[model samples]
Target: MRISAVPDAADVDLEKIDLFDPLLYSDGDPHPIWTAMRQRAPLHRQVLPDGRQFWSVTRHGDACRVLSAHREFSSERGSLLHQLGKGDAASGKMLVSADPPRHSELRGPLNRMFSAKAVASAEPRIRRAVLATLPPPGHSGPWDVATSAALLPMAVAASFMAFPEEDWVDLVQWTSMAAAPEDPSFRVSSPAATLAIAHHQLFDYFAKHMRHRRANPGEDVVSYLTTMRAGSEQLTDEEVVYNCYSLLLGANATTPHTVAGTILAMAEHAPHFLRHGDADGTRVPLLIEEGLRWTSPASSFLRHAVQDVTLSGGTVREGDAVVVWVGSANRDEEVFSEPFRFDLTRDAGRHIAFGFGPHYCLGSALARIALRIYFSEFLRRFAGAELAGDPVHLRSNFIAGLVHLPMSLVPRAGT
Candidate 1:
């Protein structure tokens, strides 16, 4: 990989650039900013307008170190930039916000449930769910990529978790509110209102299901976790609800963005992104990896340093918040050759899009299965696809993605 020359520390003013600003993500591109930071200030400290501070890690090596060394850089404080200053209410209880050995205890059963074998067993149901989102054979017109794609992940998650299928569409709305409330399309009155309504609805819905599932338990995620145990400890009602919220939030938030981004890349990026997908069905996995890499839907994760640690960039003091930009790390020119070019022929060797180490995405297998089936069906049904209208990006520093993608798919002859 060739190292591109960027402005030195003397030339680029870092303070003026607010990485936390959702507008910067919605209306502008942050990749150039990340590239500049990667070269000049890989471990630069950023102060919010109110004087609160956190360190931003942009380089790939430093991100890996920070994410893998989970103990030294703990998540128990908070795991997202939005949760800065104020600690997470779900800390220690939620899998994404918990630190080990408790993180392991909470995650072990989920790991088994989300393993490859489990996804394979559920693949047929997942495929059925995915197929419902696309046009039927011999039919192709204008497709609402955003509206249709968002349904696929929720349907898969709800089916697996045994949540009512009737509520899948609303669950998508709740996730949008939770993940990108600032966005005009998703917001309700105010961000606080957005959060309050989403949380209340989600928790209330899950609580009802939890109580019912306890009596009429079956082979589903809620029931499985309700009975899951590590050693003598079992998951509490709160833990079950919070974790289910985490699961649904993740599915609704990340997977659809990935699907849209991959489609956008394929239809709009001209030559570079479409090469691998047009090959054979066997290449769908590789395409999914590239899509995950290119979009990096979950932009950054925040970890509080429990102990003083040294990164490739510099030293992180104890009690300091460490924001690892996984999106930036995925696009680091040092790790990837021509990082901007969306090429699927290249191997998915170094992307930390799903994150790294102990906190690597629990839904990764399920996500891949969803995408694989989605793309497989898409390729078979559509002769080609193209962007049809202006794409709308979600306004968020946390969940980075487009909220709406208008597209048209060309139906294959005889399909």
Candidate 2:
């Protein structure tokens, strides 16, 4: 609840800071804490309230090293901060949680689908989806940018998977619950209960869809996945269903927050918005990258040390959980000059916002295209926009996102 300015690095008590606490991120300003960690304790260790302890990798290089060394740092156990016990449904089935060989097998078939060229091919569809989600021209004032930004990504996901348009809302709801189970709006009986229910719902939905895709194949992601093979192995029904769930969650969850954050950034920093408006097509890509870096929506993912590893003068024993803070890494002063400033022209492509290494986000390409189209259309339609009220950040350490952003849009005069 306190909004005090971040103290000097020396003043910070590394032991006292709880990076896993959801409230640390509730204000949408975890940068200062991360900055202190990166500078003073790049390999800080802390224990969660539940008595689980993990090493937090805050620096860019260290984070990259941990993420890249999949052999030494495994994701097979789980990728979330909260450890899902052996009984947990999504422990190793999802693509993000699989280790190499298996990781390669899961991701190999979908590589081309998310390639730069493939995402470029989806631009027109993404643009149409963006346009469809935008409010009618001449309608403006105190709109919830978060809700508006949230809609198109789900629509795009449905289009990509050949899922029903009517089910987009359901997809959004389930993914939201799964992603931010601690948030009051999305939480059901409890975080675990909410996640279990959401997982069940998503699995059921995908299972039914997978059955249909097998019976009558189409050119969607589901159809391709159903037929995809890995050497002598083929995807199981559970694999297909769980991976579909993974894709849906990955594709739907992060971009909307980035889009909403972009709008907020532009409104707060008018010069940036003006520059974006005046720039050519090449500049748009930079803007999109900047948005991803600035927002860092998919904040942190956990990796388990498969073997003893020395990082930043700290030893992480085998089986120790290592939390790689992508959001922190993106703003590390070592890699990014003036990291706090939102400089669209900066080489933000180097940012690990989509993460690094084997478990890197599969839908990164699609997310970029969706964000580009959304911003392009948004700027063209609205001459200027401003925040109408305080933004509400999602209460989850895993996702740095705005769940609500009230904004007033000023349409282009002629429109």
Candidate 3:
């Protein structure tokens, strides 16, 4: 269902008092707004600039309800605030846009590949990649935390997809463009045009590798996609291409930003890290979970209501869109004591940073492994680190990402 018309000033005026504005996220800290929403209007409705109205589920319980009740809130319609044209190639083909039993069908073949065991097996290689990308011991100066954190995930994803070493930079660029289409550095003409270009480039890149893998299957993910069958049917070319794009985009986007956010959190909240002493492997998992909760890089995901549903705060009509604000939910005071404080001891495992239910992030395990290894290695190399400059956040509301994070790593005194 489309919005009837641009909301009148009266309606817009009501929303203006709250943090429902997407632009608010791009400006600076949205925690105050989110906190107000959680207290005042957990399930708030706001009209977009284009007049489309969506319900924002900010409370933790409400966010979980919206995300987990797939039957009531369908993903097939579209998972973004802006609806895709019916003819758009990725409309329902990407994993995030599919509902069960199609969602289950599509997810089954790839489950083993990203299972706990699989991610664990990849740890050593991920460690090496992290180590290789980190500055050497005596190296010290301004470093881009976002760039540094991005390397291992990109390298691991490229290796998993069997992408050529030389093309890793291209893969990173395309994924960044796709995820941050609103950023001036990545935007080309318009967000739609930028996304379309990025999608096309990724599809073409994967198609070439897929064709090769089809003829000569290897152990990599691309090979698995090319050869795997579901029941009597093979995955359509569209499915293969779009899902490959999904994996590549998913692998590169969230973790890097979270890592950068974690480092910044460490610098800003020095006592949190210092109290635990050096970042040992024992506490890395806790730190990673906290980082994921603190960063929540993949902020909000839109789901269309399949039927009328009543949430804790209000009712949503059928066909209306509801945005599950995972970032806000992660900071819900009701669930997290002293929510804003970045405490490593907090049981943050329940955070929905990876989302929830059917569309929960497929690469979450891999992401956690990458984060754990990267931070462990980071701590070993650098006794301390500090932000050298302000972090520049991505413009898009969907992705809570840092385009640049200038930091200076304090190399171990002896090293």
- lDDT of model 1 at position 80: 80
Model 2, 231: alpha-carbon shift in Å? Answer: 2.3
Q: What is the C-alpha RMSD of each candidate to the true structure, in Å?
A: 3.1, 2.3, 5.1
For model 2, the run of ten residues with the poorest summed lDDT:
1-10
lDDT of 3 at 108: 86
Between candidates 1 and 2, the one scoring higher on lDDT is 1
Candidate 2 at 344: error in angstroms? 2.1
TM-score of 2: 0.94
Candidate 1 vs. truth: CA RMSD? 3.1
lDDT-based ranking = 1, 2, 3
TM-score, one value per model: 0.94, 0.94, 0.92
Q: How accurate is candidate 3 locally (lDDT)?
A: 0.77
Which digits, one per residue and each the tens of the lDDT, describe model 3 over residues 331-412?
8878888777788788898899999998888998888877877777677667777778877777777788777889887776
- The residue pairs that clash in candidate 3, if any, are none
Each model's C-alpha lDDT? Answer: 0.83, 0.80, 0.77
